[model samples]
Target: MEDRLVMDGLPAFGLEVGAFSSVDLVTAYFGRIADVSNLNAVTDPLHGIPILIKNNIASIENNNTAGSLALLGARTPRDAFVASRLRAAGAVILGKTGLSQWANFRSSNSSNGWSAHGGQVFGAYVQNQDPSGSSSGSGVSAALGLAAACLGTETDGSILSPAQRNGVVGIKPSVGLTSRDLVIPISEHQDTIGPMASDVKSAAYVLQAVAGQDPNDNYTSAIPNSIPTLPDYVAACNPDALSGARIGVPSNVLELFLDFDNSRQVEVTSFLSALSTIRRAGAEVVENTNFTELAAWANSSAETIVLRADFVTNLASYLSKLSFNPNNITSLADVSRFTKTVQPGPEEFPSRNTATWDAALDAQSGFGNTDPRFFPFLQENLFLGGEGGLLGALDRHDLDAIILPTSFAPGFAAIVGAPAVTVPLGFYPAGTPTVMNRRGNLVDTAEGVPYGISFLGRRFEEAKLIGFAFAFEQLTKVRGTVKPFVVPKTEIRRGV
Candidate 1:
């Protein structure tokens, strides 16, 4: 199956850049099924399943480039904590998938799927449409059946956005639930590895395998006792799980798109249709709920300040740990210099320059732990995004979870270190006009795009989110497995 997908030129879509030998993969597949009884209970759900680890996640057998030219050909010294767990659970490590260069942190105008090392990744449904960032290849590969499931790391919307755009299920677990050790970093405050799969069950299976405490990451040491004793998530995928579930619908999110004319109407109608489905499933939908304080914090300079500072600090820390640092690149400044020397200029690698890195360095220059402004920034971001924000809204509404268009709520969950699960809502019709005429002129002939709805839960409330997502998935059956792209013989001959 893996060979067939590779032969179809799925690599051109940037789904996979490198993989283990077929012999090693087969041996591991058989070895896992044979060893499962001792390592796991009789119900080792992921036994013999093949999964792809995102390139940024360390894997000893595959290159861990994080989709950057600067780290090309780099090899991991050990498996990432998640990767080790996947192996222990009897899953085959298929390979490393491509990603947005530096997880889409290199430039403001950079394309979502474009990587300096792997080129652009196209969407599963439409060849030319964007495959939303960072986790672009992971989402595409899962949707197209290239792998049983794929691991994707998210900071903000990296996992859910691509899953939404590609019509797949993505679960961004709470920060401490998944270890970030051995993965490339953007910000430790928000970064987490999660699963992208064709269905909620598969995502849940992957999550069960990869999630747990890790000695290397101090954050995991404090995991709530509730998480450790939780039941198997695969057993929690009840079709009637939404019955009596209280969900809040944030009106501010809808208002953000209310002025887009027909597109806005279509999206709103779709959202309302989803609400109808939820009601029919016996869930109470609380309408017009607003995250008033969250909106203010999201719009403020606090997020930018913290992210910029953390990116420089966290990335520098990760770089220093790399066992195969051939370039002797020890800091963000070294990375900037390497990019300038190797890639040269914007004219040659138009969207892959180091402008964002330079800007982050400048902003973070005088920042330190002892600085009064530094700790306050972190404290305020957590306070405003957590207790005073999402948790407050949930308590105010007496809600079990919040549902919004996938695009709107990921940032909220990310900032608060909460969990979110995105499932396919529906797809816009082909040729549906997505853009409005600013001069009051209507435009036609736009490509269809997939949209998803997200379930946002309190910190460490992954079980609730998964149950809701599974129930909604079973109710709608909106997700479809995509066919692999067939490379034309002529193009194949032309070496494309």
Candidate 2:
């Protein structure tokens, strides 16, 4: 759509024409599948719908730049598994959405939605609202109905946080449920891609198209062999699945939110109400399901050690696969130099340094998972997500899912590679104070800025979590209530 909007047979048009009037020029229409996909049209749920992928996901037609200037013209060998799956499901490739530069892995204290290539992306709900990200652009795209839905990659909070902030549904799949081939890397162990859509069922529909094995991504081979085929995720949108379901709430995890963000406690006002709603829907809301070792895990440097070690190696692997590399960047050290030494100041060095890259390069251990100390650090995380965290809470409480404020929920599952879904919870009140983040430009709180509740569970349990999210979504229909300040109406009519 970016290409379509900027280029055509015409000369000067957008200068005078309103965005709504240039509708025909904006849409990137493609041929609808007949026998192209192996499945029937009836079975291809996303057939004919236009879907957007994040800028990082490699597509042959688009540059897989990860919003960095260095890779601006670089091409990919083929579509990412996410993109290929969308094509296989008879969906149209709408285009790419912006992301945090290097999926928010580039620098410390960087703004959530700013990318050197994509510019600063803000939420539509309020004036300069912080569109929580790496996946910020995708979340905002869905929030504004730019397409049916948009796909976003998550190594952690990228998908979930932005979805809540944007008043939409975001599914952060358990790692390995979707292929990461050709997508930009942060940490291979945690990186996974999922859909951000207007609602739970819509997200499920999108997830159904892409959830499967791809030989290119060996991580996907981890899908249980016993399950010859994946479950019918769309059908799993059972509105009544919440009935007689046992859901747990971790007070300890919730307590840590105060340290994470000042407004974290206030933001969960509706989350407290969501518990009552869950109870009325016939789900038992088990309280005080504590992650006793959460404090210890949070205080430890285990997660950082894992991410830094993984990143230094994983990033090089991604760079090695580029079909065309304009800058001859084959390593993080090369990328760092390009960002620092490049004449035009495109990388914003003084403001946003390559400190993260520097740290990764300086990692005491050898390349990532191969490091001898890697397993011990990984085990520390496993303990947090497993016996000490989300997994442990589930088994200890005999729970179907764990519910928490979306802002506070992603970490436990992230460390352990478990699935989590966030649905619209509530918005800040009309008189809420405007708050700015460390970046000094991005707003953290304001009137009508959205928040969400999350349902997290074991790996490969996305179907069950989606069911619960669907029930909650149907009950609330809260997405409709909160409207953006400048509502975008993407009515594709005839060209002028």
Q: Can you give the TM-score per candidate against the true fold?
A: 0.83, 0.89
Lowest summed-lDDT stretch of 10 residues in model 1?
Answer: 36-45
- Per-residue lDDT, model 2, residue 89, is 77
**Predicted candidate 2 versus true structure: per-residue lDDT over 1-496, tens digit per residue:** 3323422112124435554332242342222111111111111122234577888888778777788888989888888988898888766576777788898888887888877776787776877777888888788777766666789999889999999998999999989999999998989889999999888878988899888988888888888732247988889999898999999999877777776766766676778877888999999999999997888878988888788788878888999998899989888888888888876787788688777777777745445667787889998998878998899989988999999999888888999999999999998887788888778887888878899999999999998999999999888888879777765433444343
TM-score of model 2 (CA atoms):
0.89
C-alpha local distance difference test of each model:
0.72, 0.80
TM-score of 1: 0.83
RMSD of 2: 8.2
In model 2, which runs have C-alpha deviations exceeding 4 angstroms? Answer: 1-49, 225-228, 363-367, 492-496
Off by over 4 Å in 1: 1-49, 226-228, 257-265, 343-351, 363-371, 434-446, 481-496
